[model samples]
Structures are given as structure tokens and as C-alpha cells.
Target: MKLEMIGDIHLGMALNRKKADFDFNVKKRYPVISVSNIEEEGYFNNKGFEYFPSTELLSKKYFTEEGEVLMRLTHPNTAVYISKKQEDLLVPSYFVKIKITDKNYLPEYVAWYLNSEETKRELQKVQSGTRVTSTSKKVLETLVIKELSIEKQKRIVDLVELHQKEKTLYEKLIKEKEKQLAAATAEIMAD
Candidate 1:
């Protein structure tokens, strides 16, 4: 099965590259099996957990609601990049949508592939602009993709979902532990 590649098309240029790098570093330090970016993106809006430890369980709150929407909005084979700007400036609103013709690939698998480092570097290579290194819709449409079977695609999606559940359970456990710790400390202080 043939695969197609595409760029992220969205407004706000909301991707924080520095934060992404930091998260990536932390993930490497902890050493998890899943992609750090996916974990980070999922945990972006979550409160309390400043950084995720490798063995530290994840919570549902860490997963970004925006990410779900963004993931669904784009074609499965599309890769999205949040623009990095030098100064505090609002990025122009734009969304690029591409259609994929391949039947063997699932959208979730394709999305993961596009988000990989190797593919990101390739997309960067195609960038022509000086200041922002913008990627055009047409360029994205022509990008190459590796095709995987439907069963494999479903398995990947399942793994991602499983991680999400684990993250949620961890979050719940952590919150409970924090509450218990606080109560115990308060009781001791009262004595």
C-alpha cells in the first residue's frame, strides 16, 4: 500500500518548541517505550504534574483535548507542527487539509508516522522559506508515507489508548496519595 505525507495545518502556531525539547529530555531520562511527544502533547494542559518521570504513571488530564480534535481534524497521514516564532506575535490563522487515497493505512498509524523525528526532519528539509520555514499544502501532499496493515494500525491505536488509560490511573493514584500525605501531615501538626 502507498502512503502519503502532509504537514500540520492550524492556527495560533501554538507549539512550544523549547517546552517540547525539555519534555523530550525528561522522557529520555526516564526512558519509556512510547513517543515522548505524544505523551507530552497529551499532558500539555494537565495541572500538578510539572514533568513526567519514566516510571511515573500518567493521568488523563495530561492529555490535551485540543490534541484529540487536532488529530481527528487532519487526515490520518498528516503531520502537524506548531510554528515557533522568535517574538510574541500571533501567527496567521491557517489550516491545511490533505486527502489520502490509500486503503491499507489507518489514520492513527499514519498520524504517528508523520509525527516521528525522521519524518519531521524530512519535512524540514522541504521547507523553503527563510524566516518561518513554511511548508506548502502541495508539498505536504507529495510527501512519502510507509504503509502498514489495518490490523497493525489498530494495534498501534490500542497501545496509545492503553497508555492514555494508564496515565489516567496514575494521575488518580497520585492525587489520592497527595491527599493522604497532606492529611497525615496536618494530623501530626495538630498533635
Candidate 2:
């Protein structure tokens, strides 16, 4: 099924405002989320975001809701599905925000598909530009997505999450082992 059939896809805030307009003194500054904040693991990295000036124009259209999927338009393009509400973060112009309109497809599942190798390969083939490669809105709309049952999507997402958690734990363990080895080497040299 085509992605447009499942949801609406549009660019994020295109306003070009200066830093002087933002209220950076307080913790409630309007945070602008960029493509750099999304990690390869399909989660928000919570880093490298800039704040925008709060204005009357900051409507519901600027913020992303739960179940919304975000895709980067620039090179190294990636997609992430928001499972929970992220307060103070507004989607920026370089990212595309997709809000699901149909119940047949899960937001997380669609995000997973977008991040998959299959989709990435497809995108790499047709993506335009030289310095800053990006997929056109029209081209992106034509992507064919596999239709899967909600139950299976949930199961797959769960399994992927589990695998990621395990991978993180293993990385931590390896770092600890390396530290221990270094300490042991130092102790032997001192003796």
C-alpha cells in the first residue's frame, strides 16, 4: 500500500527565526527537533536541538503527537515513530512529519519499514541532489509498503526492541571488561 493512503506527510516548520527571539533563560523554551536528534536505533537522541521563540503562531500543527512518524529530508535520511509525547519539541523544516489517518497500519510498523534495508535501498536509488541529497515529496509518496496485521507488527517491534536492549547491555559489558583488563595490567606492572 502507498504511504499517503495511511497518513498525511508534510514538511515541518519552515520559519526562519533568529536566536534573539527565543526565551533561552528558562527551561520552557520552544525546542526545535532536527534530523540529527534521531539515532540509528530508531529513537530520539535528545541532543543537538535548538530552541525557537514562543509565539502565538506555535499551534498544534508545529508539535508532533504520539503515533506520528518523522523522516529526515537530507542525506543520511532516517525515520522515527514517536511512541510517547515529547513536550517542548517542534519539528523543523528539514524533516517530514507523518500523521496516521488510517488504522490499518501501525505507526511504529511503518517506521520500521522505512528504516529497513529494503526501503533504504529503494530511497538511495531515486534520491536526488548532489551536495544535499533528498527525496522529493512526490517520489516519497510512491513508495510501496507491505501491509501486515497489527498483531504481527507489534510482535516484530517487540522483538526488535528486545534485541536492541540486549545489544546495549553487551556493549556495556565489553567496555567494563576492557576497563578491568587495563586495571589488571597496571597492577601487575606496579608489582
Candidate 3:
């Protein structure tokens, strides 16, 4: 199942042809979301996002609105969904911003699908460069994904969110257990 098979992908395809302009050395007020901003569990972590030097770049041209999907252009492995109900966030050049035009499929579904192992494998096949493997715009345009009902997509997204929450709680639990173990060991050794 391919994206084109569902509907007119070109209609939904919204690639800001304008090149991302920002001076990395110059820090500014606006926060820019890079690939690193995405956490290990495929969630946004704004603790250390970079600042775009140009406020002019923040205009709809370079920023991501709600439900917009941002994928890593270099590796094409991570797809971070902009689901926050707030002002647009700037997306840097390292990532490709995708706007799903198809009403049948939700943007969240597309983001989740892009981050799936199957999609990664397919992207890897067309990626170039031995040192830093990367997929191109053409590759993204022709990418195939399993076509499913909107309801199923919603359920999948919900399950993934639940799994992420579980993973986060599990990590915290492990950390607390480790601290307890360390303190107990120290007390016993001192005795």
C-alpha cells in the first residue's frame, strides 16, 4: 500500500521549498526543533532545543503547526509529531516537515507509520552515502505504508502512546530501585 494509492498525495504534499535559513552560532529567542529534540521513545524533549537566529524564518514557511509531522532528513529514522495546541515551532534543515493532505489518514498516523520498522527498512533501501546514510525528497514522495482505516490508525496511535507512558514509568522505577540498592550497599559496607 502506497500513499498515492489512497488519494492525490500531491494535494496534501506541503514541502516548504524555501531553504531553512539560520545561523547555528547565533542563539536567538525562538526554539527550533531538531532531530535531537525527539526523545528515545519518540516524544518531544524541549530541554535542549536549538534557537533559530532569524525570527523571519519563524513564519509558516519554516515552522510546524499542529498535527504536522517532522522526519529526519539525514537518517529518515525518527518522525516527530507536532501535536501541541500552541503556536508553530520552527523545524530545522536536518528534518523534513510533512503535511498529510489525505483526509482518510490522520497526520499522527502518518508520523507513527514513518517511525515504524517497516518504513525504516524501506527508506534504508533508497538511502545513499556510506558514512551518513540519508534518504532524499524523491524517496519520501514514493514511500509506501500500510493503508488502514482511520479508526485503526487512531487505535494504533493510542497504543503507542500507552506503550511510551509505560516505558517512561518503567525507567523511573528502575532508577528508584537502583538508588535504593546503592544506599543499602553503602550502609551495609559502613557497618
Candidate 4:
């Protein structure tokens, strides 16, 4: 199913675009997420987000929930699945949040697809800009996604995670081997 078919997808802070006007209060401030807080590998980076103070007359449904997907609009566009919520965290104007309204499609599944090579290539095609490439909100809605059974989607996520773990272990083993080889060579040279 196309991304649009699953839920309401739109820019996070369409109502407020000016960054200079923001007022952050130390006592009442809320954490805010930006493109840099989202990793290209499709995960959230909790380290770099800033906080914005609570303001009067904020609209409802402004904050993202667990399972909602966020996509960056700037160059090297990337999306992340909201696995957990950082309390009172708000997404700013530079990102679009996709709330999966339908139960048929899994939000995690869609996030995985968005980070895949196929989606990346498609995004690269539509992105325009020299200094900072970007994809428009309208263009974002048009991006396509395949519909897969929940079971299949879960399996895919599992496989990818397994591969990642194995890759880490292999890298560690290689490093250990390299250290051993270096030590052996040093000893032989000394002799």
C-alpha cells in the first residue's frame, strides 16, 4: 500500500516555522526533535535534541506517539520509527511525521521500507537543491510502499536485526585477529 493509504502524513510544525521566535523556558521547556536527531539507519538519536518551552494555545495531537514515523526534509533525507516516546518532545518544522491510522499496515514495516535502498533512490530522484537538497511535503505523500502481511514484516525486521548483530561480532573478531597479527610481527622483528 502507498504511504498515504496507511494514515495522516504531514509536516510536524506547519503552524510555526520561525525558529527565532521560539522561547524556551527552563522550567516548562519540552524536548524538540530535528533532522540530526534521526539517524539515516532509521533509529532515533536521543543525544542531540533541544528543548522548547511550553506555550499557550498549542494545538492537540502535536506530539508524536510510539509507532509514528518521522522523515527528514533536508539533504540526505532519512526517516525513523518512534519506538519510544521522550516525554513532551515536539517535532519542529523541518520534519514530517507520518501517523499510521490504519491497523492493516505496521508503522515499523513502513519505517523499514523508507530506509531501504529502493526508497532512498526514489527520494534522491525527487530531491532538489544545491546546498541542501530537500523533498517537498507534496512529494513525500506520493512516495509508494508495498503492503506486506504483519507476519512477514516482523520476520524481515528480525532478520535485519540478526544480521546487524552478526556483523558487529565479525568486526570485533577481525580487530582481535589484527591485534594478534601485529603483536606476532613485532616479536619476530625484535628477534
Local distance difference test values of all predictions, in order: 0.43, 0.78, 0.69, 0.75
Relative to the true structure, candidate 2 reaches a TM of 0.85
Q: Tens digits of per-residue lDDT for model 2 on 36-150?
A: 6788767776476776765444667778788788888776668888767555468887888888788988888888888899888999999998888888777778888899898
lDDT by residue (tens digit), candidate 4, 1-191: 66777778877775343233545522345567866676667666547677665544355466777878888888667777776664345777778889889897777778788889988889989888888888888887888888888899898878766865786689799999999999999999999
> Against the correct fold, how does model 3 do in TM-score?
0.81
Q: Model 1 reaches what TM-score against the true structure? A: 0.48
The residue pairs found clashing in candidate 1 are: 8-80, 42-62, 42-63, 43-62, 58-167, 59-167
Error of 2 at 79 (Å): 0.9
Runs in model 1 deviating more than 4 A are 1-39, 42-95, 124-139
Residue 161 CA displacement from its true place in model 1, Å: 1.4
Instruction: Give the worst 10-residue stretch by lDDT in candidate 1.
Output: 81-90
Candidate 2 Cα errors over 4 Å, as ranges: 18-28, 46-49, 53-57, 85-88
Top candidate by lDDT: 2
Cα-based lDDT at residue 188, candidate 1: 100
28-134: candidate 1 lDDT, tens digit per residue: 22111112222332221223223323323333222332222122212222342222211112222233322333556555566566666676677777766665456
Top of the candidates by TM-score: 2
- Candidate 4 segments whose C-alpha is farther than 4 A from its true place: 14-27, 46-48, 54-57, 163-191
lDDT of 2: 0.78
Look at candidate 4 and give me any clashing residue pairs: 1-147
Reference-based TM-score of each model: 0.48, 0.85, 0.81, 0.75
